[model samples]
Target chain A: MSTPRTALVRLVAGREISVKLRDKGFLASTAVFIAIIVLAVVVPVMLEGDTPEYTVAATGHAGAVAEVAVELGGAEVPGLPAADITVIGLEDPTAGAGGDPVDEAFLRGADAVLSSDPDGTVVITAQENVPGDLEELIAAASSAVTAQDVAVEAGLSADQLAALTSPPQPRIDLLDPKPSLPVPPELVIVIFGFLFYFTVLTFGASIAQSVVEEKTSRVVEILVAAVPVRWLLAGKVLGNAAMALGQVVLIVGAGLVGAQAIGEGDIVAQVLGVSGWFLAFFVLGFLMLACLWAVAGSLASRIEELQSTTLYMQLAVMTPFFSAILIRDEGPARVALSYFPLTAPLMMPARVATGDAAAWEPWVAMVIVSATAVLLIGVGARLYSGSVLNTSTRTRLGGAWAAGGRA
Target chain B: MTDATLAVQGLTHDFGQRRALDDVSFEVRPGRLTGFVGANGAGKTTTMRAIVGVLRPDAGTVTFGGASMTLEVRRRIGYMPEERGLYPKMKVAEQLVYLARVLGVTKDDAQARAASLLEGLDLAERRDDLLHTLSLGNQQRVQVAAALIHEPDLLILDEPFSGLDPIAMDAMAERLRDRAAAGVPVLFSSHQLDLVERLCDDLVVIHHGRVVAAGDARALREQRAGRRYRVDVGGTDAWMPALAGMTVVGSGPEGTLVDLDESADPQALLAAAQAAGPVEHFARTVPSLAELFAEVVR
Candidate 1:
């Protein structure tokens, strides 16, 4: 009558997956993450890369000033093509075609109009505000023209006037410089480490909460009677791990695809290369902690009690996560930490990012964590098996382990 | 019958230093509803847990169909713990089907069984509702239905009727009876002796982790009766209390009931009742199951 243990495990795991898939919170959070990834990738491309161009409508004297302005402005604007200046001629008042031509130029999309009044005062007009660069250019041109004429009248040569007009600006420096932002490699490592830390805690605590829920509801008793205790543990751990891992993959996949689509292929290659290493570490690390989370759940009989029982596991996951983030330099300490199984998931990815990890370092670290995680699975299953059944009393891990020894 | 009898023999368990069960033994025979009675903490739950393999007995053999319990046999046992355990968020019908599926029932069979049990228990309307949304009495009915969903060969229910309303109790009792009639060995523990007395074909009384009394229901009553007699006199005359080695146990419109010591004969007590006044009626009265439980427990 009984089903195989693997089938029961599969059934339980499937139920867990289906339950989370049906959860509104899970779906909503997943959606939010994808949205963030899309926005992060797409927003920047839409905002940059525009070059300003100026079109001016000018009569006789102002036409000369507009040409000079273009020359000065073209040299000043960095990282953009020189702003092009188009000058359209209009009839002078002497021709008796007065304000109409100015109005005509305005209809033709001229950026600004320049002219000289009968009294010889300069006039510059824009229907809207002119661009800052354009305005600065025109003002500089007006002053330069007046200065050059005055210098010639006063018998100074063009070279001398040009030298005098261009002032020598002193260079400024900071006494204390802040360090540069993280390089792409380190940044990716930090991001990957952060995701690993965040998801492990989130999914781990969720697994713990669910376990306590089953214990409190006594649904676990029914489960225990029908299936082996370890199978339930294995199912729950694998189920929630799947949720966490899949979410991580979904979020990263979304971000990476968005990045690749928008011509951020450099980023795509940077992240994609080390992704396998981080994922391998992530699976091993997540697998190790997920078992303990089940233990945390079994140790506490009530939901409220879960907070205290789960704290140790929180510390266990958090310590290495914080260490990986804080220890950025390439050194013996970092290298040793990367090799340590508990710290490896967080540290090795960072080392990989910094190019400090050798090609085989991650492989060795993975082997160590894989061996440890597999070993801990047995221990966690024992603790969970011992504690989950004594539902009436809030079973302690030690008590359960002792009882597990006897049973 | 031999193939279907769930025989639990010499079931002994110790919790730390405390002996929870000591040489407990009983049978849930085929085609009978066996009522298991005990006081609180009297090892009914422990014995049930042992039978279903939830708790390992320190010493004992639990065999079904004359073979030691295997995974196959254990799956055939439908056990409900003293505490009600079902997913509060899960739908009623879905939960039942899931339990049956875990026991290796096909999806079609599980679905059909779930629907049928729900209809029979008057919970068809609430089948899709979350378990917590139902009233507690209705939830108890669902718990009983869960045990029956797997079409189990043996049903062991602990405190299955404790929280049931009268109507819900009757519906569940009917289900258990139906299962028994279908040749399943149904063993349920309860504090409600009257209900047990009315429904049970056989009884097992455990006190202090020991089987104090167990037998065919009517046969137990017969064996424990015949020591007391009821006599009705023409007038309100109390004569039994004055007689030697006789005690007046109760007085009613019909008679004065007297308990006779070995020296005081039941016939002699009847004669004394006639001498006091013209005797109207005289007969021996058997105790109800409630009285039997109380006497056996004492």
Candidate 2:
């Protein structure tokens, strides 16, 4: 025969899971969240621009300039992608300027058009929505060729002309070396911090709300009579934890697949490599806070009063989120938070992701969090048992403790 | 069916300095419906709570089938609190099955039992509906169904008949009788004395946190019966004034209710009434449960 306590716990957990899964609001919200993950992954791939390449059409005297311009434009710019410039010779020499309007096909094929007016002014016509960098590249090429022409006309030597046309390069040496802080890891850390904060807050409040609902409806009396109070608490924690873990996996999995499809797979891989640590911390952290949520819920007799009663729990969850974001770069603060169980779950994973903590720090934090969770479970169970059956008004924590002790 | 007897002995409890129950004791025999009648705040709820282990009494104990009420035995008993509670968001059938499963019933068995209970309560058609959607009367039936789903050895219901209509009351009373007939002791608290008088085989009357009266329903009435007699005669009321030890309390078209001293011979009074005219009726009136409750409580 099964132990009645275990059986009772399983029954309560099963009921919680089934009821929440059947809630239309929960289903709709989860669906919306999944859609967001998909979009976050796919939108970047759609927005990534291809290698920069430009085709130029030249006529008459501008052909020489165009030739030199194409060579220089094709060279890589300091901070921009290298441009590929192709000069298509016009048979009429003035075809680009006055002979006939360029056909739609040519306009579509060439990025820009170049021609010389009869008075000798060079004109460059670019396509609509040409990026600023591309326009700068074309201008630099044209100016270089023009400068070379003027130098040649003034009888300057080849060396002088080259010196005049080329821009100077500056060089410096740093006394101290700094590690490169890549944009992706920083972005990932912030995102993970928020994820931890919101997940804990939302689910924690949910646990509290569920408890208060049962209390207000007086269903808890029947429940307490049937099963031990601690077992009921465990069942609720387990049920919500299962749901929370499912949500985490869905989000992380979507993120990884999206990152991979967009060629940012390495960043996601690095994040996932440490996600095991994140998962461990999340479960421990959520369990620790979830216990308090159950206690907070038991204190309130009605749903309207639930919010005020659970405010401290909400604030506790938010403290870590804000601390992680505000003190992200403060090494000492991060180290201190990593040791504290309340903030450790949010901070430790981020520290590991950013390569800021020692290898053993996360393990230490995990141990501390797990121990704290056990302790809180005991305290929370007492509170739950003490106040769960009292439906008269708000139950004080101390009163509940006393009641629980008597029981 | 297990024959279970519930016994509460010297159960005393307090809320802070206020005494909720004082030396309360009662017995519910197997295969009997015991009505726990008490006025408001008379410790009925507290006594029931103690029996179910929801409240720890400062003194005394509740025993089931000759054993102290342990978790194992508590599981074998069903309790419905004064505040009827069921998950409003849960379907009627599912909620019943869940409660049964918590008590260690197999899932399939729980489901079958829930279905049967709903059918018996005339709620089979509404089984799939959420509890909050049902009328209060239907919900009361579902609450009753929840309490009975596990086929507990003892049934404890607090005010199970309060919000029920007459039809629902009849059904609930019949169900309780059926359970008792199966050898399960049923202890229920209610302020509805008429229904209690009609339905309960045994009555436990509580006043000021004490068991003032208990035992067979008819026996308690006969025990509490005073020396009051109702006499009907064909002729006048003049003879009533001449009676020495008998005081006329009430007179109606049917008869005159006389309060006789304990030393007064009722047979002599009957003869005198017959001599005056034709004796139509002469009998002592038995106290109602309500009258008994009022008398004991006062």
lDDT of 2 at A121: 72
The C-alpha RMSD of each candidate to the native structure, in angstroms, is 5.8, 3.7
What lDDT does the true structure give each of the candidates? 0.84, 0.83
Per-residue lDDT tens digits for candidate 2, residues B19-98, read 88999988999999999999999999999999988888999999987889877788887789889899999999989988
**Candidate 2 regions off by >4 Å?**
A52-55, A60-78, A82-87, A93-109, A116-122, A127-130, A140-183, B1-3, B235-249, B259-265
- Candidate 2 residue-wise lDDT, A281-324, digit = tens: 88899999998998999999989888788989989899888887
The DockQ-derived docking category for candidate 1 is acceptable
* Model 2: colliding residue pairs: A60-A93
Positional deviation of B104 in candidate 2, in angstroms?
A: 1.7
Give fnat (model 2). 0.75
In candidate 1, the residue pairs with backbone N, CA or C atoms under 3 Å apart (3 or more residues apart, or in different chains) clash, namely none
On DockQ, the candidate that comes out on top is 2
